[model samples]
Target: MNVPELFEEGWYWTSTQYSPNLAWSQSFDDGLQGNLVKDYEGRVRVVRRFPLN
Candidate 1:
């Protein structure tokens, strides 16, 4: 998959929940996966999956 033109360099929330107060996040800048507080400000990317038939 290719990165979108409007991609921003920062941490983005994932669907995975790390804990009651933390969640999984990914960094677009360096492709790092980490956890961040639920209340912290972050970016999000809306995407959909398609079958490779």
Candidate 2:
């Protein structure tokens, strides 16, 4: 997702499903070093350091 230059934050949505027959669960990396940040309202505000480079 592309954010405006004026903002230091961005957002997006995703969906996935898992199969019960699979021996291992799906896993991936965003190359970030931090956990998800949340607002006072308990909504996700930022996903820390999702490195693309």
Say which candidate scores most in lDDT. Answer: 1
Taken over the whole model, the C-alpha lDDT of each candidate is 0.89, 0.29
lDDT of 1 by residue, 13-34 (tens): 9988999999999988888999
What would the per-residue lDDT of candidate 2 be over residues 1-53, giving only the tens digit for each residue?
56445333333221222233222111122322222223212112344557687
Q: How many clashes in candidate 1?
A: 0
Off by over 4 Å in 1: none
Candidate 2 has a TM-score of 0.15
Clashing residue pairs in candidate 2 are: none
Q: State the TM-score for model 1.
A: 0.81
Clashes of 2: 0
TM-score of each: 0.81, 0.15
Name the lDDT of candidate 1. Answer: 0.89
